[model samples]
Target: MSQGVEFNRLMLEMRSMQADAMVRQKPVASTPEPGAPSFSEMLGQAVGKVNETQQASSQLSTAFEMGTSGVDLTDVMIASQKASVSFQAMTQVRNKLVQAYQDIMQMPV
Candidate 1:
């Protein structure tokens, strides 16, 4: 009778621990608010950031070319490269968006 009681107690403790573990491991899910923009909005924001970076880079290049006291050749080169990369990335994104739209249109409805 004592052994039976001990076994039952152990099983209860194990079940309680399992329940606690499961509760702790529950996944968190979030739903976006109404009127929130979707993936395209996020993508547009990212592209805008890139464009801003490119513009800053161009300004830096101009400053360097004008023989500004604080500007250096290396700084200008790096800025130019950064701007070029951003421009290329934006171009690629535009191309991909266009292609996706075309593919969707071509899909049989």
Candidate 2:
């Protein structure tokens, strides 16, 4: 295959992997009850997942930098991008939460 075709194939594979990961990460819908996970627990879990992704990306990059034969440049790039996007998403969520807290603080009793 041509160089362009090969690159495109790799990109497609990366995207498919990302989508599958996201699908697997989604929680199943369930009725909220006293025994259910609290909002704080859910948020904590989300943050933990983001941290895991960043750590995974770091480890992959380290291996690639070490010239590991099993590490592919394309895989490293994909992992880095995934980590970046997830981090950005988490940051946005944090910003929104802070803003909401500030708004509530300023509200009249």
Q: Identify the leading candidate in terms of TM-score.
A: 2
User: What's model 2's TM-score?
Assistant: 0.69
lDDT tens digits, residue span 1-109, model 2: 3444545654575567447555545355855555555667767877897899899999999999999999998888877877787788779889999999999999999
TM-score of each: 0.62, 0.69
Let me know the TM-score candidate 1 reaches against the reference structure: 0.62
lDDT of 1 by residue, 72-96 (tens): 7776666566556557766887899
How high is the CA lDDT of each candidate model?
A: 0.68, 0.76
State residue 35's C-alpha deviation in candidate 1, in Å: 9.2
